[model samples]
Target: MFIEDIRNDFYNILLGNRVLLLVHYDVDAICACKILQGLFKCDNISYTLVPVGGISELKTAYEENNEEIKYVVLINCGGTIDLVDILQPDEEVVFFVLDSHKPTDICNVYSDGQVRLVYKDDEENIPNFDDIFRDEEDDENEESGSGREGLEALVERRRARKEWEERRHTLMFNYTQFSYYGKPSACVLIELSALASRLSQAALWAAAVAAEAHAALYVRSPARCLLDAEALHRYVAAARRHDDSTANRTACVVMEKDAWLPLYREWTLEAALSHAAMLAPKLKLYARSGSSRLRQLLADMGFPLQQARQAYRSMDVELRRSLLTALETAAPKHKLPVPTKATFILQRPHMSPLAALDAVYVIMALIEHETLPKAEGFQLALAALEVSGENEAWRKGSAAARRCLQAVASLVHATLSARKLLLAGPFSYFIVQDGTPEASVVRGPLWLGEAARWAAGGAARPLLASAATDPHTSILLGLPPRFEQEPRNLFGAAFEQAATKSGVTVSLDNVDTSVITLPTSQRAQFLDALTALLA
Candidate 1:
């Protein structure tokens, strides 16, 4: 069911049809949706887009919008779950799914002509169809014969079918043992849409942010992130060659070595260093001496106290330019690893450059905005992705992102100070009390993840974090303590396995399996099961 030809088998097939586009509520999906919308506009393809949060919502959206639509395109969802069985669309309907969620449902992988996977990941070793399925020929043979010889053959066939079923179960469990993301869906669409053509800046930035979202969320491995960057090098090269001397200003994305700290460019030197994931743990920021250690490191880097305390933009030009080199030089003495990385920055004529990492944070924050309606937040997120002269959307999202990060840092400090982060067998965990200032902030998975990673001092074990959503229910998220080149998450599978044995009803309703919601009262029991499962 995997389509080899993106244009012919996927794009061309939807040229003149009315399509129902169901996009998941995530930064990557929003960026991918924006690119697909552009592609659809270019081809004059009629489509209705509905943002879905989970499986039930996806079904509802599809059923409501699929009245007259024969071609449906799903962004970032519906791949890991059985679509045809759940949606139950008419025979004429053909679904083209572009989900980055890995370990796609075997049913979807081998589905008949109705379900078509638009993108195929080379990393997935999907079992052969025959290995996982056997026809009902045994029943057919029994129906067609009754003689002793036929009866014996039928019994033999039944035994063979049972063995095949058992093998299939094992194969499926091994295949779906973990959940992770593949390449950004936006990157795939951009590549296939361009068809070896030069890269478009707007589309490229979207792709870059989408890729960074995977990294920022730890859903994609560092090695995979590098591969995502390699896929966009041509675009960066083209942007580098473009002339920005024209009257009309255009944004250009360029690669540069910068700090790994998110939103550092927009924050003051002291604040960025203090809250940064890499430096915070290394500096032991939760302890009383954390401040002196930070000042000492800055002093060692030769950054003046005044300059270090001021906004990054207000810092002296020479100091700003040499920041990376200074950090690299002083890092070894401070027991800090080199924190600089070659990353993308959006450059416009007179505007401050925006980091792709920052963009990911911005969009994610907007989408998870507490007060704003989801539809409005969705629009705001799309607008934020646009690198325009008057980037009001970007500014708004940036402000929200900053607040979110500050809350995460605050929560991490509070948790550590209160000695709430406790080890639970195979994982370490902390809970955000209901009325805490940052409890609302950490309720969203992205912010909670940020808090979790920061709180995981040495990242000694896989971390599980929970935030109270209500008196009866709480949301829990699991994360690996640390990952290197290959970040395979065992948490998703762990959550499900523990749920089965725990005898507690937990909801793994989110598209990302790492996140779940469970009864507040039964959380301790669920944790015990998880501990037992992981142990």
Candidate 2:
């Protein structure tokens, strides 16, 4: 019913308006954008696609283009954000949120017809429609009863109401639990396309895109499988019928098993190509401006301007294959493992973060497929060497990697030295004194990963490790094989109370895997307090 209501509004708003599509930089968001773009093209609507990373970028993009934009459709984001607070006081731009994230109090703040928030709520926890109607029928049929019977009926009704309230209070989005990948955002787009009579042409593409997003989660942590098997199978079958390719079939199979598979491996070539195809338009835009090495590579690989543009439109399998090959050839070569460890170094000068991450994907795929002996856990050190002065991005990335390595080393040494370490659930707790070399260079996530590996003597669960940065600040990091039920923020009331007792300040930087800042002077006291709380 909620979806149908939003669908009616969405169709109404699309009439005679130019559209601005703001999408997140992920597979799901990209797929949703493609689906909407296809629909817009069919309807002869002019639209612009803008890929944004965070709330700040979304705000900036809106401010710059709000004048020309009549309708803004946000995909995969903007649900949790308070849009009314972010938008200009008098801005009349219409917004349609197709997101699954938790929403803020926007409807109450902005009651105008300009904003429409479409999302899943606590519907699952609510009584079923049949049950509600049945209860109403029973109420109507009930006759005046004895005092005892009436009292019993009142008590039973109150008990049922309490149970419903408890369920409502505990309700959470299913996707957060990795139960299914058919998110409301994607489903809404599918339904919209069906209403327009384009489902036959567009459904498979949308499903494949959602499937790819679902599959991507497995690459990092198989223990936390994100795709529903039945849903994934159905999508994969649809993809096969739409355009059966070796890559498509391989992706479906790999996704089903919840295993680690490289995107560029022979079997997953299609998925890799799809990724390149999605990126081609963005690459082409960059190519038009200045001299880009990637553009040149595409040209050298026999893809001229016309051919490159065509690939963006159609995502031809052969073109995708060619592009994937060229990228692989141009990618930075992996170095030999460190003497006795599974650490490989890769350096490419002036590479963008996207390119660097792509390289990581490629390399990880290779390693996983190769299954090299003596590989306990693999560590990759990537650097974008600067030709000019100093590349700050590369410097920062390299420094973080170095810090991780140093932190791992310190952790291992401490473990061998029998330093006091406490284990609570998936957490391995220890503290570093302020101003120490180790404290200065230690990073939370990296430390947790390496420490967990050593502590477990094999594959490890998600872990949390903390270190004191200074007398008034402590850093916390969580390594993942995460579940939905895990506590988001590490420092809660108990930790705050401990901080207060020790005259420390506590601050959480993020929700998941938070970087907690607290007083360093009471490091031991804080650890003790945390231990007691955790215990």
Candidate 3:
């Protein structure tokens, strides 16, 4: 069976107590172990690992540690019929039969009351045998030992116990080293090693998911295990292999449908490999049905692939293209058109072309709020506007031109209503812009360039420095052509008036207005005048 099936089976065993993980020391087994660990991390289960030497060690481990072993997860070992039988009466046994499948006879067993036999595909879905096994009368016989007299009760117990012991047993019994926990009888089944490794793996998987076709996979793990070096190395290797194969396969499939891969030659094979590796597991899952599968996965995961691609330019090639195609293919299958109300904020007052054009930054900001990952894009755009002094152009009570004021007000209202823009009472530090541009004459958001820069900085954390925390004087130099005898005097006047009223006491050197550009060299006198006014 595949990794998913094994993972799901392990999950069921984890429902019991004190689990042990046994695997060969080989790379495949190691990868399998790491993969198993990734799943456990999601559930906060714990585990102990036993390196495979022979069944002697496993039997010893089981015999000595059965008291602590609640569940046994065997990896890289085919069907462990004998091991399963030995561990069965004492504890719940679960083996992720990786790279090998055991004969069917060894696998049949009674669980939750009914006899269950797991086939390859059905491995993941544990049969809820509770109903099949428990009759109404047996349900009433709730007392543990109430069903039989001593001899008869013992026989019934033996029979029931014997039936339960065969659950995970496969033909490869005595030869393969098996995993069994010491304390199997208790309800404490968890393997910490397995759980932690699984968590790290899942995190890696999530990153891959985010990178691949802009799919986002959110994992909530019950326990927190910091993936150390060994765990990470194992994860990286498995992720790379998984991603490469999946990507290659998906790329082939997508290309067949006239869909292009999101990545290109510009990306180093290693880099592309890394990105694809993360999404590999899910890629096959979504890639099977062409575009429709991909789109559905995106919607189910609550991920906005289009927005994510725009935010991460490199993704435009593979994720954006493939996703759009998939969405288009799947669109027809739903039969009914999504209501305009559902798809967009329809029937709002129409803005003039110019008005809409000017509102791009505002709209983008609002989009960021409505989407997941909390819109790092919006934050950057807002920062840029604040830096450009465009934000300060409007005052709380000062009379400004009605048109500009209304545009800004509308932007704010739209963003606020969308739950994306955070207003910190009369503009504190970052004045977030929201509203899309509807007017061609208005062009793109005036603050877009700056916002883009800020967003870039966020992607390069630790190494990249952050923007200033304080607000500075903003000067908008609307220098007219040929009339630039010098506008420094006017700029100085605005700066002087705005700076003091804004209560900024930074050095003229520290002021941000000069950061974007030097006022026309001819405006030196004006600069001095402005300097004097601020001082």
Best by TM-score: 1
Could you give candidate 1's per-residue lDDT for residues 252-354 as a string of tens digits?
8888887877787888888888877777877887788988999999999999899988889989999998999999998999989888888888888787788
- Please give the ranking of all candidate structures by lDDT, highest first, separated by commas: 1, 2, 3
Report lDDT (CA) for all predictions: 0.84, 0.44, 0.31
The TM-scores, one per candidate, come to 0.94, 0.45, 0.24
Q: In candidate 2, which residue ranges exceed 4 Å CA deviation?
A: 1-6, 88-91, 103-114, 121-184, 199-206, 215-260, 264-426, 429-462, 465-535
lDDT of 1 at 3: 89
At residue 512, give the lDDT of candidate 3.
16
Candidate 1's displacement at residue 410, Å, is 1.0
- For residue 15, model 1's alpha carbon misses the true position, in angstroms, by 1.5
In the range 206-255, model 3's lDDT, one tens digit per residue, is 22221211111101111111111223335445545665677632110010
Candidate 1 stretches with Cα past 4 Å from truth are 140-155, 196-199, 244-249, 457-460
lDDT of 2: 0.44
Whichever of 1 and 2 has more lDDT, that candidate is 1
User: Which candidate comes out best when scored by lDDT?
Assistant: 1
lDDT of 2 by residue, 1-535 (tens): 2333654668656767888878764445544665676678777887776666557778877787776677888886665555667666346777787764332233412435566765454412323443222355645535445599887876787677667656544442221222122253554566566667665324433434343433332212222223322343444346455545443322111122211212222223222222332232223222224236445545555566555544233545676555534544433321211111111111213431122222233222221222222121121111122212234433433334433433544554454356455566535655545555655444333244344333323223444466654455666544333322222223333455555665545553322213355555555566666556556
CA-only RMSD, every prediction: 2.2, 15.6, 29.2
